[model samples]
Target: MMGPAAMLLLLLLLFPVASAAGSRTLVFILAGQSNMGGRGGATNGTWDGVVPPQCAPSPRILRLSPALRWEEAREPLHAGIDLHNVLGVGPGMPFAHAVLHSHVLPPDTVVGLVPCAQGATPIANWSRGTELYERMLTRTRAALAECGGQGKLAALLWYQGEADTIRREDAELYTGRMETFVRDVRRDLAMPDLLVIQVGLATGQGKFIKLVREAQKGVKLPNVKYVDAKGLPIANDYTHLTTPAQVQLGKMLAKSYLATL
Candidate 1:
């Protein structure tokens, strides 16, 4: 019988093309809703597939596929993970790229990005018992395990709240739900001090945008930080971040990530 790791590897459709010696990987989880899942060229019902220069692939970065395999990291990092959305570009790639360029870690360290953000998902959907929450944890654990015990989960990047803004009740409960979500994830992962960098809302689903943004900013979790997306340019629908804005957000995420170190 295959060992657990072996069984997991067998399910992966892509294997990492790592460095010759395979450096230790520092993993980051990109979660939340549409913004974190990216929507760069998405318009109408299709994606234009235009990747920006800043979000380009790098030799030192790899992303965990929806199938749990590690593949060369590329644009639209959440394409396979965020099932319902037409993905174009998200912040994961550019964030990883900026982190690498900043040389925050050792020069040889590899970055593993695990994209688990399902677009249009409400914070309520991420409660402990839900399939979405379970899947996120399962995939994240698998990611840390894949690198032969050499991978470390560095942080989680969250960027949801717009969905909750649609309903007054949801908006009212946003901060408490987010606080619970953060606590739950940190506890379950056995990383109570795990760093979390969350983006404050720039756009929203309804009248509660302000309330939801306040909720995002109000979470007082330790080691948790905030990056505001309020002024970033939006896409055609004035909802999702544009390609350039995604690049900027990636840089912002990198700034926050680097600051933690």
Candidate 2:
């Protein structure tokens, strides 16, 4: 009952939407300090044959390789062995798997991760004015572009604050600065509705940890979600997470993200 011209126009209008619906692509930004960079070792098993239940061939998961390039050790030249040894499983993999299992995405959905993390770097280091943060931002932008542009970015997962806790004044300014950083990242990426997952630091004990948690909770951003790492076990180093604990944390992060979707 439709004219040829009308039908053509309708098809034109719906083409992009239909295509997007058919193949959903999610780009996840993983940025923070050491934890976000993944301190654990790579799995001895092969990942090529592994596929999450929800992932399709077209929209596959992409993770930044050559790990630890972004880890900012005190000397900046320290070997990554220690960091790699403790590395078990981090949040990125589980998050992707959970999204697929949740069935919240379309068929042929691909999830990508762009990790930019540095150890021993304070929140201020990621500030807009700082060179370190600027470099990180540049790298993140490049990674996103390489992955397929803004359409790919579904969320930004952050796990930091340990370094900031070392200083009382920095701790006081953490929340506001974090808010600003999130805003800046959104603006830079030109994605206003991008979800942000802020994982609170897992320091064994202290009022400082509590303050950081309160600050994250008080931020009041609708798209910003918080993950608690309070009771999680830590590595023998007393700061980082053990391999098993990291795996659990990864699962927890995936669950949190899935809940939002």
Candidate 3:
């Protein structure tokens, strides 16, 4: 079977880049743990500072910084937001680039990425009403308002679950937690049928990884879809995705999103 990287290349060869979309910037939320925040180049307490062209900065793709400012996005996107760690290549920019060029969205549409994932956070922390959850919502609303017009939330991209795999109870109850998180976000965002793309774990920090993985895949929401990252290359830590793999995951996400339309 073709691997994700090759499949992404195939998608590129098969589709034409779109050129027109709404005038308002389309936004997406990047939520989850360290992997989602990105630990690509931070293999040993430091980021290698390598930015692949796929994940490079662009005027069309923007990131909402920790201070809620929209800036031209680059690697290590969760710099201050996912505090207490070195950052590096993440799926956010790559996803944006792929979506920008894919038939999914117009090539000219501005993509706004809201980086709200914090390293070491578990699904429980993201439950509605918690500081983590409230903050994500607050930051997203602020970021959208910064779009200079009536920007719409295109979708939400989530990559997490490592924190919940540490114990039997957490792993077992993850289905409920995961379901609630998605449901609550949709409710609060007033986007009842929002497009949600969730990345399945490539690896985990605990033995209950299988359980958490199953829960993630079991979500049966209307527009919720899962992109497998199980076989993707991992970092030296065997947890977070590497730079190239992150790019592949992004394209995979774009493929999943485009399939829905």
The top-ranked prediction according to TM-score is 1
Candidate 3, 1-261: lDDT as tens digits = 999999978875554222111245888999999888988878788888888889987777888888887777888889888887888888888888988888556545788889999888889999999998999999989877776565788888999899888998998898788889999999999989988888888788788899999988888778889999998888878788888888899889888877876
Please, what are the lDDT tens digits per residue for candidate 2 over residues 1-261?
999999978885766333332244566776776666554332332112322322222224444433412211111111242133323345566566667666678757766556566666778888886865665566566555544433366788888888777667777888898999988888877877788988878862234766776777777777998887777877555666644555566667777877876
Whichever of 2 and 3 has more TM-score, that candidate is 3
Residue runs of model 1 more than 4 Å from their true location after superposition: 1-22
lDDT of each: 0.87, 0.61, 0.84
Candidate 1 has its poorest 10 consecutive residues by lDDT at: 13-22
TM-score of each: 0.92, 0.71, 0.89
Winner on lDDT between 1 and 2 is: 1
lDDT of 2 at 27: 62
Q: What is the lDDT of candidate 2?
A: 0.61
